[model samples]
Target: CPALGDVFCIAQCYRAEKSRTRRHLAEYTHVDAECPFISYDDLLDRIEDLIVDVVDRVLKHREAHLLDEVNPTFKQPKKPFKRMNYSDGVEWLKAHGIKNEETGKFYEFGEDIPELPGRKLSDKSSKLVILMLPPIISPTPGINTSTLMIREVIFDRCEKKERILPIR
Candidate 1:
């Protein structure tokens, strides 16, 4: 098959997830893309571009009024989203005294940052910052799943909406 520059799918997807998290939905429109011969960095860049482009188009159309109603002060994110490595993020969490809920110990390297815990960490960072963490590969029993990190959008204090856009 000849290579295609970039292909994306935005479809109605369903998942039977047991946990209740803001990031989880029983059925939602899932947006995914595939690009042949692209490096990981290229993939990240493409994803950021797609998101920003979509938001820009929406804001330019009448749908933006609907968006504004939901988030009145919502604004299009600037380019070059902030990024962080997995090890560095773990250190940041430890430095801020965030402990794992399952194990009372501090979050260490190779530890999975679940949605709730990730939100807690995002709460401590600057408002509207994007945090990207590397994927975790585990060989232990009952922990073999590769969990993609969280993308938190936090509404900061004083009822002002601040967002954290994490992409990995």
Candidate 2:
């Protein structure tokens, strides 16, 4: 996997590509050069410098937004005030139209609720109900089985709302 710096470099490259102009040309070129030649030690140094520069710029910008010298006042309330437990979150989900097979327990839209009252499928059930559901064992040979399983799970989870079920 590429390191954080590499990812940042790639993003910077993309932005540079989008905003290609004479003034920004040098900055984009630097980012491109920074991408491929990143040896382990070079990457570490570049990442450290990047972190320091980012911190310095953030501190400077935030200082300008401070109401008092000692502390800065927040501009707006942060979203998602606090995290809720799984059960509480599930209850909220149920309130919002996701039906739990059981009366009180609420499962998210597409989340399989095997523990619910009317649910007959086991929690570990792997039966494919959706036709578009990719096979666990890939038709293409040589591709990793584990990779295929992961892909299948992701595809199913992503398409859960669209999946046709007997109850639905």
Candidate 3:
């Protein structure tokens, strides 16, 4: 078998969005890794592990006091972050009586969760949410391989969270 390896990058990025929100920035730093060979389950596991590890490191580091001051309400997210499939998330929104912003109707499966609604859902869900199976499944661009991609988002409750929503 040919040797295959993971690829990662941290780069300055810009968005072409017209609507501005706390989460939507004209420019930001994007860090991502492409592991074309990993299984779906493995990707989820790795993401959780990475989040936990990063938090642990941050909390233990000498500059931990800075984080405490910046987000005084912050706390270490529990292990095995709550997992919600797209369908379940839609059901949760519907159960919570959250309506779609654009359509002004009850949220249905395959609908994009608007920011406010999504935040409400996340706030009620837990500290760290592992939302999986977003509406897109396309071959990843800028990465070496052409493997179909899936989205696995981890939300932090204390701050505005970024949604790595689109995969082109």
Best by TM-score: 3
Q: Give the TM-score of candidate 1.
A: 0.65
lDDT of each: 0.58, 0.35, 0.64
lDDT of 2: 0.35
Every model's TM-score: 0.65, 0.22, 0.70
Per-candidate alpha-carbon RMSD to the true structure: 9.3, 16.8, 7.6
lDDT of 3: 0.64
Residue 163, candidate 2: Cα error in Å is 36
Candidate 1 achieves a global lDDT of 0.58
The order by descending TM-score is 3, 1, 2
Per-residue lDDT of 1-168 in model 3, one digit per residue for the tens? 125588778899888878566667899987687776787668777877877787899899999999867778776776676767766778888888889878889987656676687768767855567666554323442222233333343331111122422110
Which scores higher on TM-score, 2 or 3?
A: 3
Residue-wise lDDT of candidate 2 within 1-168, one digit each (tens)? 235333433333324254433233434433322244454345434434554565457566846555345445322212212222333334454555556645555565434333232122211123212112222234443343433422224432221112111111
Instruction: Give stretches of model 1 more than 4 Å off.
Output: 101-104, 116-133, 138-168
lDDT of 1 by residue, 1-168 (tens): 126667777899888778576676788997666565666557566656767898789888976789867778565666675555555667888888888988999987656677666766555554334444443243432232333323222221111111234322
